[model samples]
Target: MKRFLGFIEKEFYHIFRDKRSLFILFGMPIAQILLFGFAITNEINNVEIAILDHSKDATTGEIINKISASKYFSINQFIEQEADIEAAFKKGKIKAVLNFENDFSKNLVKEKQATIQVITDATDPNTANTISNYINSILQNYQLDQNKDIKIVYQIVPQTRMIYNPELKSVFMFVPGVMTIILMLVSAMMTSISITREKELGTMEILLVSPLKPFQVIIGKVVPYIFLSMINAVVIILLSIFIFKMPVQGSLFLLGLESVLFIITSLTLGILISTISATQQTAMMISLMGLMLPVILLSGFIFPISSMPAPLQIISHFIPAKWFIIILKGIMLKGVGISLLWKETLILLAMTLFFIGLSIKKYKIRLE
Candidate 1:
């Protein structure tokens, strides 16, 4: 017990002594959370647009007024000639161009129908689709008001139930992803680099020659990381709850348990990396470039798996972060219990076993 405490104390010194790494470990979670929460979101607002109204009537004027009044769009430019449309788009001032057909009011009154062409830049498909949808919604509302006296034959109202995140809070989606990233950095990157540092400095050889068993030395090194990762998880959860007003829909105990499991899995991976790499730099590079990118891009963290190409979607299944995210979403948003998440939990367990087995095999090979 005394030896274990001393080892733990040494680990704390290593963590606290380096201000830069400590700052990165603690600061990155908040920074990433804020960045993803505010900056990278599916919702589009205040999109700049251009208007080309050939109608020059009450209907076209009202349509323009309606669009400009809404929060989603701002009428940045009004093009006179048809040729200006391409120029404005090329300059990138407008994302979409709303054009009212000639004699819109006259046609709507006499023919009981009107046509408006919404030309959108398809380079950014998501933004373009959102802009078009917003415009259509505004027009539909206007048409509903104008036709208040007339009865419509077909009334199709979309019953949209935004599952997982009912309120469409981008923060909800980010919480799990942020937590995973923090755990990955803290457990995998930090442990692997710290272990490799000892190897680089020749302290690892001394330890291996000491009375401490190989597993004991590795466990002593990893225990502090496990504790630190858990602390980070707590910090992130508290920040989400208090700072961002994110609710804990499921049991806190379950969340903590799953976090611990993921931390262990990450630490095992770190152990494997440390055994394979001779220097801290290599460990850090591998952890960041190899593991981090896949977690962020392929784990359904930043992009939806369903929308991805078929091959990519199949490949995403192998990412451990994907399972972790699924477990998190089920617990945090859907408020599901072990019954729903047992399969994911089992998969994580299997992955942890696989990583630990591989690390042990690699370590044995090194010893021989």
Candidate 2:
């Protein structure tokens, strides 16, 4: 019994002393909990939307007021022409639009019925569908209010017209996730290994001493992998489009730009890992433990962030993939341009700068 206890203590000593082992055992669980909390959720709130009130009547005004008062939606803009609804959705400014037909009050008075068109950008079908349901619920309550004196049912059926993806394909939800995972695996894992291999061979030190600055050398090392990861990204997109028939509603140029930015982010993160690790095995383990799990499980790729716990929901904001997946869905599914997605774009840019800065700092520390 004494010998067995001593053996266990010795093993624990080995684990605690190794930084990588300590990180894997302790740091990983904290990271997982935080990621899951922030990234997964089953609720919706504060959805952006537009209104096109052709009726412009007293009743219509009241209905619009009711919708605007609800916590589920924030009216981003008002459109005059029916043609501009498509334009607003393409710009990604609003998730849904409430279109009150021209003779809304007249029809409601004479026929006890009127049409309200709820147009939605269905890139992320879940969000679009939820917004429609919320609007419908509000309208149903309004119907009950106005018809208190009448014995007839005043039905205000909301016609939820799904734009971009009429069929609400499940594949559309995953294209961004799958592409993110693939690009992450390829760019991050390989870049870490390649850089660590150079470090092991003493080539990284030689390059550091060359005419090129450390940043230039690191960029030179990662440039080739960026091309390779881009190729992987293109292949994934092509397969998603051809096999799944997932529509690219947004600009392809913008999609390409976002993909490239993600690839660079992954590469920079991998470089940071390489700086901390001494061998290829160490780099690989760090990349897998640090980047891959958080991205795959906690990035809102498979799970809805609204369903997650409050603490985890708050923590998920720090994951880079969470923002990138959003950007992907907005472009590929919603057909939204950069104008509507600037916030997510800036988040990704900030993450990239952070990783590069941290990696450089570590590299300088090693030299001393």
Candidate 3:
């Protein structure tokens, strides 16, 4: 027991001794959490837009006032001619241009509807779509206000609602995926690199020849990473809760347990990778190319897996992060219990077992 504890201490020393590794382990999680939480978000804010009001009427002025007053947009400039619209967009600061048709108030009084041309820069499709939606919403609100004093013959009001994320904050969508990625980076990438570094430094053979068994050696190497990764997990959760005001509606205990399961799964994957790779560079490449890409692209982190092509959807099932992401969003967003997440939990467990078995088999063969 003393010897095993000493080996664990030695591994800790190896980790803390390397400045680059320390930074990657600690600094990356904070930087990534801050970046994803604060900077990378889908919510639009104070978009600069140019307006062209051909009518120059009271109603058009009111609509413009409402639009400019709303937090979503700031009127950059009101242009005189239509030709200037293209130049404004070409300059690249403005996201949208709102053009009211001539005699907008007269048309509304005569036909009960007025035309408004919303020209948006399609450079960023999402941003453009959001800008258009905001404009439409503001117009709809103004129209409702106009009709509030008058009686309507037949009104069919469609009440659209959003559950879970009512405000649709992108942070809610990204937190789970970011947590998964951080765990993957620490568990799989770090462990694989640590093990490979040992082999490269000629220290792994010394341990292999020591009184300690191979299983003990592997466990010793991975245990420190598991603790460090969990610390990272805690930090991420705390940041989401306090800074972002993100609620963990489900069982915090379940979240932690599932996190541990994923951590173990990631650690086993690193072990499997290390067994196959003889050099640190090879392990790092495999972790980034093979693991990172699949986790980021295929895991339904940024893109919905269901929306993917049939072939890619089929391939995504093999990616562990997909299941983990579902588990995360379920627990964090929906507040779901284990009863709801049994399948994903079981899948992660099975993957963990498979990787551990394969790694052990390969390591034994290498020993022979």
Candidate 4:
């Protein structure tokens, strides 16, 4: 019993001494729980929406005020005309637009009913559905409030139109998200171990003594994975198109170019991970734990980013997957060209350069 107790104490000491173990045991759980608790939510708050008041009457004004008063949505803009709605959605700021039919108050008084068209950008179908429902609920409550003392009960009918994805196909949303995850993880996981494996197997010294330069070594390590990841991306895109009947409304050439850029970004990030890590296991852990959760949760793939707390929303901007997902959705669903997508494209390019530069610096440090 004394010997067993001594062994147990030794194990505890070992665990406490290793920072990685301590982090895994205590830090990771706390972080994961906090992230999950905050990130994984269905309810949206401060979702940006637009209003196109055709009637511009007291009734429309009251309804708009009620929607704006709710905690669920914020009125981002008041659109001028019907033609601008498509342009607004393509800009990717507004999620839903409330279009009050002409003569709304007069119709409510004379015909005892009025129609408000709820047009939503359904690239993310779940969010679009939720927005439509919330607006409908607000209209219903307003109707009830106005009908309290009247013999003729007034009705406000909400007609919801889901653009881009009229059927609200969940797959339309998931394909882009899954594709982003696959490209991010596979590319990162593959090259993350490249340098660590060399270090572990005593081959790093051989490379160190070779005629090849540091950049040459780094490029050599990453170039193969670039081709492999590209193939993986092509396969995923083809499968999505043929099997799922997913449409690529934008230019295929542009899509290919963007995919290549993201793949390079992910691969360079993997190289950076490889340079910093001491062991293959460590590299793998960092790549999986550090990359996967953020990609899934904060990328606005599963949940709306605008719905999250202000801090998480700010942190999400740092997530490359979030930008890549935006690019994919823009190209696939909205069919917007590079003119509209230039900002996101530039952000990915900048990230790629940043990762490459950092990897080179880290590699030089290892050489010294």
Candidate 5:
């Protein structure tokens, strides 16, 4: 018991003595939350749109007025010629261009309708779609107001309810993913590098020749990291719950259990990495470049899998971080139970077992 406490105290010194890493470990979650909350949002507000009104009549003027009055569109430019529209977009000034057809009032009175073209830059598709929808909503509202006195035979009203995120807040999607990535980095990457450091320093040989079993040595090394990562997870959850006002609708106990499972899975990966890497530098590099990038890009963390190419989407299935993040979101945001997240939980367990099995095999080979 004394020896274990001393070992834990040594681990604490190793962790706290490093000022830079300590700062990163504690500071990163707060920084990431702020960045994702304020900066990287999907919601569009006051998007700049240009107007190209070929018609100078009442109908076109009214439509333009309605668009300009709405909060979504800020009409920065009124292009006289069609040529200017391309130049404005080339300069990256405007996202959309609303063009009213020639003789809009005449067509509306004579033909009972006027044509308006919405030209959007598809380079950033989400923003483009939002701008287009905003314009459509303004027009539809104006039409409804104008036709309130007249009777229509049938009206098709489309009702929408956002299932996962009612407010369409990207933070709701990001908090779980960010939490997963942070835990993975701190537990897996840091532990891997630290273990490799022991090997590089000739300390592993001394530990191996000691009375402690190989598995026990590895467990002792990783146990402190597991506790640290649990602290990180708790801190992140508290920030998300209190600061962001995000809810954990599912069982808190279940969330903690799943988190521990994921931490163990990540620790197994760290062990595998340590077994493969001969040096601390190599371990760190492998963890950052190989694990972190794939976890971020392919894990459906920032971008939706549905939006990716078929090949990348297929590749994402193998990333354990992907499954863990999905489970976190299911439990945290959607308040889903074990019934919904069982598949992801099973996949994580399988990954953990696979990594541990591979590491054991590799370690035995090294021993022989």
Candidate 6:
């Protein structure tokens, strides 16, 4: 019994002394609980929406006021005409647009009913559905409150039009997110584990001492993985189109180019991980824990970023997967070209450059 107690005490001391073990035991749970609690939410707050009021009447004004008063929505803009709605959605700022039909108040009073067309950008079908439901609820509550004393009960009908995805297919949303995750995790894990394996087996020192330069070494290490990742991407896209009937509304050439760029960005990030990590296990752990979680939770893949807390939303901007997912959705669903997608494309390019520079610097330090 005494020897067994000594062994248990030694195990406790070993766990406490290792910083990584301490973090895995205590820090990870705390961080995961906080991230899951805040990020995994169905309710949306301060979602940006626009209004197109043709009536310009008291009834429309009151309804707009009521919508603006709620914390669920923030009136981003008041659109002028019907043609502007498409442009607004392509710009990727407005989620839903409330278009009040002409002669709203007069029709309500004369015909005892009125119709409000709810046009939603349904690239993210869940959010579109939720926005439509919230608006309908508001209209119902308003109708009930106004008709309490009247003999003829007034009705406000919401005709919801889900553009881009009328059927609200879950596959439309999942494909882009899954593709982003696969590219990021696979590319990163492949390169990170490859380089770290060389280090673990003592072959990296042989390569370092060779005539090849560090940049050349890095490029050679990543080139094979880059080709493999592109093939994986093409296979995924083909499967999505052929098996699932997913449409590629935009240019395929442009999609291929953007995918190559994201793959490079992910590979460069992996190289950075390899430089800092001493073993394949550490690199794999970092790739899974550091990259996978952010890609799933913070990339607006599973949940709306506008619905997350302010800090998480801000942190999401740094995530490359977030921008790639946006780009994929824009091309696949909206048929948006390079003009509308330039900003996100540029962001991914900049991240690629930043990661490349940092990885090279780290590699040079390790060489020294």
Report the C-alpha lDDT of model 5 over 1-368, residue by residue, as the tens digit: 99999999999998798654554567655644543344334555566778888988887787788777866668879999788875666444466788777877777666667777787754334455566677777777877887788764222122222233445565676788889889999989999998899889999989998999988999999999999999999999999999987878778999999999999999999999998887787688678766776777678676544345456667778888988887787677656778767888999999999999999999998878
- Tens-place lDDT per residue, model 3, 280-364, is 9778977876688678767867754433445666778888898898888777766778877899999999999999999989988
Question: What number of backbone clashes does candidate 2 have, counting pairs of residues 3 or more apart or in separate chains?
Answer: 17
lDDT of each: 0.77, 0.83, 0.79, 0.91, 0.76, 0.92
Per-residue accuracy of model 1 over 1-368 as CA lDDT, tens digit each: 99999999999998798665654577656654643444345665667888888889987898799889987788988888688876666443467787777777787877777777777754334455666777888888988887777764222122222223334467877888989998988899999998899989988879988999988999999999999999999999999899977777788999999989999999998898898877787688678866787788778687645444456667778888989987776676656678778888898899899999999998899877
Q: Least lDDT summed over 10 consecutive residues: which range in candidate 1?
A: 153-162
Question: Candidate 3: where is the Cα deviation over 4 Å?
Answer: 1-157
Model 1 ranges off by over 4 Å? 1-153
- TM-score of candidate 5 against the unseen true structure: 0.60
Residue-level lDDT of model 4, residues 41-149, one tens digit each, is: 9998999999999999988998999999999999999999999999999999999999999999999999998999999999999999898888898899999999999
Predict model 3's lDDT versus the native: 0.79
Compared with the true structure, model 3 gives a TM-score of: 0.60
lDDT of 2 by residue, 237-332 (tens): 999989998878789999999999999999888888888888898888778777777777667787655555666567678888888998998888
Q: The CA-based lDDT of model 5 is what? A: 0.76
| Model 5 per-residue lDDT at 313 | 61
What TM-score fits each model?
0.60, 0.81, 0.60, 0.95, 0.60, 0.95
Q: State the lDDT at 95 in candidate 4.
A: 97
How high is the lDDT of residue 243 in model 1?
Answer: 92
Candidate with the larger TM-score of 3 and 4: 4
C-alpha lDDT (0 to 100) for residue 118 of candidate 5 = 81
Off by over 4 Å in 5: 1-157
Weakest lDDT window of 10 consecutive positions for candidate 3: 153-162
